[model samples]
Target: MTPVPTAPLVRWYRTSLAGHPDGLNFRRLWVGDTFSQFGTQVGLIVLPLLAVSVLGADEFEMGLLATFETLAFLVIGLPAGAWVDRMRKREVLVVADLVRGLALLTLPAAWLLETLTFPLVLVVAAVVGVATVFFDVAYQSYLPSLVPSERISEGNAKLQVSQSVAQIAGPGLGGVLVRALGAPLVVLLDALSYFASVLFLLRIRHREGPIRRSGRRLHSEIGEGLAFVFREPLLRRIVATTALGNLAGSVTNSMLVLYAIRDLGIGETGLGLALSVGAVGGLAGALLAEPLLKRVGEGRTIALALLPALPMYVLVPLAEGHPGQAAVTMIATSMAITGVGVVVYNVAQVSFRQRLCPRPLLGRMNASVRFVVWGTMPVGAFLGGVIGSRFGVLTALWVGVAGQALAVLPVLLSPLVRMRDLPRGLDQHA
Candidate 1:
């Protein structure tokens, strides 16, 4: 037989294996990430519920609790990125998970001792927030090291699917458990999930590169990351879009449980069921993202995905005076639609940034983007609380939805709208 072009076949083989589970350390990462996401999803519900239902926290205090959970991203966000770069990302992931698990354990312990207080909840939230900052930066930075550049999108899709699945099940599970076992005891499950994540993480065998130290001042290192993000027009725009979105989303989220339980008279089961139903949209988004990106182009996908959800948010505040079942349905519908946009936007934007940055700057770049985007969360949460407390929860929802409507403007006006595909290999523009 004639030579079958060995070189081409070898190249094709490598390409075929790029995103497959067995080809890299992604399988273990995926498993660990799933557990972590499940824990986080459950915590998202129970933590706030623990404060509101158990400790009798009002709207402003609820906002404060939300602020504490995200406060670390604002305070240590920039420095955490620089720090992650100088350390083994895997180690950082492991340590972050460990810290979160331990801190979460304190909640159940406090509860068992009958010493559970809002302040204790706040402290634990703050600790978990700090660990989460490190974990997020490390996890994003670590993915590029684990998979080939071309397969980052695939890896992200799979990870997002896992997160989506967790979202789908977690709230309902948390509700049932909280109702059955009490919210305090339910926290223990979230803690256990984090521990499970650690075990899965330890099983990964992918060796990361030795830590690279610049021996430079911390501020300077941070500045480099900031500079990279700001210097790129597209990245800067994406940051603005996401920051605004987070601000709006946090405002709404901070008030959502309070509004649902108090204003709408949604029982725990109804609230959880609504949130769980909404997560189905996230799963759909994750599954559809790749194909949508291929069809619409990555940049356009980011821009387009956000628009459909703008009006969807209006359905939320508008549900205020409806019957309980109708209100819950409206809330679930809004969540499901918004969840789809959020997931699709995230998968596209995150993959684009990962592909755009050099490997060394991955940690800093991810951190910088998150710093800008997530930093807005606490501020928004605080504003939500203040607004909800002063005006009314329904008014706060209206204000939040209005902000969500405007958040799309940044990306819509950018060159992303005109482009068919996001550029690759360090090129910031199409």
Candidate 2:
């Protein structure tokens, strides 16, 4: 891995914010992040619902929409990291937010004007997808710069709480807004969320110098990030586990709503409730993560979180009932478990990555990681669609769930299993 150039940061262990120990800068970042993410969650639901309800998209079209939504991770994931490293993280984040907001705003306008087309929806999805590639990479990279090194764990844990809260709240809020104002109006909420995020980001007073240009060729820089990840044993392990697991997850996700509504006899309301119930587990995981990590250590925490979800995944495929009320309970339980496992693992590993990698390479490293890990999602969604259509949705569920279950094996056998704490280097900010 390439070494990061260490920058000095303030120690924030003694501060109090509403009785919390984190600093004001982190609070600003978190608030902005939460607002944007809440909007994102709203957008995520409203867009697809609109696709089906307003655009009259079929299963195939929904699959394509899912693919386009994440395909940017594979397409621009690497280079975006490189560009992010050459630019101010805040600027990159702000521009990405603006782009996403503007792209989404077009949807409501087109719908109001009665000029919305299915292809136009796909274009909007794709554009947002591309901008997200940059936003996400910069977002992850920005954290270590905003807080003390020792506090990165707390920062990550806190951020996960916001995300988990969003997961729990965003969908329900979105549903209500959709019901009150309709789908297009619900999209306006997301567009406005981006603006809200921008407002918070603009309020952040942290400054950055001109991007340190390595003057290396873009492809070479991209390759360097990839090589760094592939070369390091821990990162390599993380990527493999996440990539395969997410691939399977994408399959389950792609088919979940369709199967619930079409095959399992569950209605949209039941499906929505099941998903909402499932998000509670994420909130729990985020809240419990610190204590869990304190007791179990990082490696085992990562491993244990995902391990339980393996067996829990079976309930989804075996779900049965008229309206699948019982099945819905079973499925929601499974999602709850999956959410806990995923959130804990995510929070722990993000802190680990921030600690392990040099600051200068954080953007590229995260981007590279996302490239390999998240890139598989689009493929998995496409595969899920193919498998569900060909073999039946239940069969597709098994394949996806089974893949997710098996992905944990790589970590159990690797160096990650034995580590008590993540290794930190001199390049880290302290």
The ten-residue window of minimal lDDT in model 2 covers 9-18
Residue-level lDDT tens digits of model 1 in 1-430: 7967789767755664334446557878889989999999999999988988899999999999999999999999999999999999888999999999999999989888989999999999999999999999999999877777877788899899999999999998998898889898899989999999999899889887677968689999899899989999988889999999899989999999898888888877888999999999999999899889888999889878888888899988988889999998998999999899999999999999999887788888889998999999999999999999999898888889888988999899988998887777654232
Q: Each prediction's Cα RMSD?
A: 5.0, 6.7
| Model number with the top lDDT | 1
Clash statistics: count for each candidate: 0, 1
TM-score of candidate 1 against the unseen true structure: 0.94
TM-score of each: 0.94, 0.92
Ten-residue region with minimum lDDT total, candidate 1: 12-21
Candidate 2: which pairs clash? 4-358
**Alpha carbon lDDT of each predicted model:** 0.90, 0.82
